[model samples]
Target: MRSARRQYLLESALMTNPLHTFQAWLDDAKRHGVHEPTAMALGTVDEHNHPSVRMVLLKHADEQGFVFYTNTESPKAMDLDHCPFASLCFYWNPPGRQVRVNGRVELVSIEEADAYFNSRPYLSRIGARASRQSQPLDGYAELERAVASEMLRYPRGHVPRPKNWTGYRVIPQMIELWKERPFRLHERLQYTRTGNHWTEQELFP
Candidate 1:
């Protein structure tokens, strides 16, 4: 009965815009108490053509692209630099819904990156410059010392975004939404980009 109602609502209330629908689903997930709703699995290919996946926090999403920040020198960032194509998968437990995006990656602008970086907490800003992501460290104490050292360089309210830290935008070519139903049946809606517009396809679960 719950599945039937959900299916009914999905069909009746489906938005024409995939990005809008994605934002709506995210809002719904937050209302449903899904922790860290913005967390997503980012998939990329390294220079050697090996596939890699990591969890990244989604900063923003719009018709333009889905955005996330990271150290530009990290392994994942290096992978993206070698190959611009990538994918993002987002799953919400309560609603049992998943969103998958496949597209080419591009770097966000310096001004834009600076604005978002400035919005983060001071400690987080310090951490970005303190630690070398994916690099070896002596120990937790070493990391703590590095953080402390970084903190002193830029007092409380004024930490500049590190040069190695910036944002990336995934220019989605295809977006798919999966809605789970009882008995293992699911509904999938896919949107493919066609120039400036989108073409929709319904897939069998």
Candidate 2:
């Protein structure tokens, strides 16, 4: 029964335009009440080839790729500087669906970063200015003092985007979609990019 379900999913899967297909699945996940549907696990490697993974919100996704923002001094940013490759995974348990992406990371344009930063809430803008991300914090009081100081400096609508806070875009080279079945049987479909087009193939689960 489970194997039949898996086979049906494989036969019905979309095999072109992985980006559009991903967006459709994401929309379904959202409609299914998946918590934090845009949240994904990002994996990066350091200069020593040691891997690190963390959860980050997906800011944007389209034909170009996925985008996420962070402080330039953060550990993830440092890892990106040393190595430009990254992998992202999105799982929606309610729908028994997962998407995996492997890509090259690049910094977004200054204009793009500034626009997104300005769209953020005023307090978030101030917090971005106050916090030195990935740095060791002295204490809770110290952070409070910093936030207070920033609040006084920026007032209400005058907070500007921090120089070191920016966005990164992951330009995907490969994308894989997985669907879980009733039993252990699963369906896996992979799409690999070649120049301007993508080639799709099924993989053994």
Candidate 3:
């Protein structure tokens, strides 16, 4: 039974585009009760080539690639401005599956950012306006005061999207998927994009 299951998974991995396959796995993770199923570790490099990584939520994903939103003035955003290349990694322990994506990053359109910003919860929008992301704050009280100030400014109506808050899309050049197995012998599949098509291959465990 274990052999049959492994074979099935391998076949499935080769049968679809990596983005679609990743979405399927993400859905399974959600169904299996994995917390923060959309969370991914984002890796980026600064102008000096220093690498930094942090966990970010995967807000969108499709044929174009993965998308996430953040403050344009944040450290990660600064790194992206200097070096647009990035990598994203998703691991779902409950399903023993992982996905890795490497690509170039680009800012989403202003219209896209506006739409998403409007959809955010009211308090979240206010918080985005209040925080000066990646900048050193005097203290917790300072942050609280900023939030309070933003609340007063917005009052009861729509909170406009901050100019520095926006979204980015990672246009993937390569994607890799891995499934765990006994004794550390794992199944690995990789897809590399060329022009409009993707070439798929299996890697040694």
lDDT of each: 0.90, 0.89, 0.90
- Tell me the deviation in Å of residue 177 in model 1: 0.6
The sequence of per-residue lDDT tens digits that candidate 1 reaches over residues 54-124 is: 99999989988999999999999999999999999999989899999999999999999999999998899
Clashes of each: 0, 0, 0
Summarize candidate 3's per-residue lDDT along 57-161 as a digit string, tens digits. 999999887999999999999999999999999999988999999999999999999999999999999999999998999999999999999999998679999
TM-score, per-candidate, Cα-based? 0.94, 0.93, 0.94
CA lDDT for candidate 1: 0.90
Model 3 segments more than 4 A misplaced = 1-7, 10-14
Question: Which residue runs of candidate 1 sit more than 4 Å off their true CA positions?
Answer: 1-9
Candidate 2 lowest-lDDT run of ten: 1-10
Candidate achieving higher TM-score, 1 or 2: 1
4-32: candidate 2 lDDT, tens digit per residue: 54446645653368898799889989999
**What is model 2's C-alpha RMSD?**
3.0
- The TM-score between candidate 3 and the true structure equals 0.94
Q: What's the TM for model 2?
A: 0.93
Q: Is candidate 1 or candidate 2 better by lDDT?
A: 1
